[model samples]
Target: MEKKCINCSQRFNCRDSYISWLFFIIGLIAAIAIRSVTFLMELGDIYAKIAWYLGVGGFFIFFVYKFRINHRRSRFIKANKLMEKVSGRLELKERDYEWIGSLLCSLSAKKERINYFVIFGLSALALVIAIYMDFVR
Candidate 1:
């Protein structure tokens, strides 16, 4: 079934939250695999291995959380916009809607960037610890 936007009365394809959930699950599995490989390879001492596993897992979990938040926010924004447009109380131009959509999308993208940096910072710290243990020990 086609989904209608709440603000703009525009009919467009909508993403299923289930798909996002699936992605999160897949990421978790990938994180586990990475940790397993690190353990098997004996990349470092026990502490270092633990650090690597935590780094990878934490990164994936952060990514999933950020993705889910942005996805839901965009969906809600789009739905609200569609509803506004269909109700015809405000009489917005097509360009106006386009601009608003672009603005919202960009904001979401910015949020992703912020989240990624935070994740990267944590992962980097973990990696540094692993490296120190492996080489500086």
Candidate 2:
């Protein structure tokens, strides 16, 4: 007898909101570290060194998190033949459709929008500072 799975067809919330918030904070630290390194150098060697370390650590953690997510998603797709199903070579059952929908929801999470806004704002600020430091003053 083939047993039916209960949760396989349901929408799953795979991403943790806390992790998103933590990454947002880490992204801010990285942005500040990179932008302030030159300004901090005028304060002291130790200050600049601290900024550099923060920048390195923040970027390292951020990229590792991103790569882990990507790897997990890719592995899931490959293991489940999701792409083949999408391409019409194979038919996806109800469970597969649910899985793909969940993946799409995960990709379009609101937390990502907030993260992108922060990154864009930081980049714009960095540009303004660079312009003032170099061309204006």
Best TM-score among the predictions, by candidate number: 2
Runs in model 1 lying further than 4 Å from the true structure: 1-16, 43-122
User: In terms of lDDT, which candidate is strongest?
Assistant: 2
Q: Which regions of candidate 2 deviate over 4 angstroms?
A: 1-17
**Whole-model alpha-carbon lDDT for candidate 2:** 0.77
Q: After superposition, how far is residue 71 of candidate 1 from its true place, in Å?
A: 16
lDDT of 1 by residue, 1-137 (tens): 65644332342343436754555455554454444443345554675566556657665775767677779766866866755774777877776677566445445443346445644664566476567657887
Per-candidate TM-scores read 0.35, 0.78
Q: How close is candidate 1 to the true structure, as a TM-score?
A: 0.35
| Residues 53-106, model 2: lDDT tens digits | 998899889878888988999999999999989997687898897778767867
- True lDDT of residue 123, candidate 1: 52
- In model 1, the Cα lDDT at residue 88 comes to 70
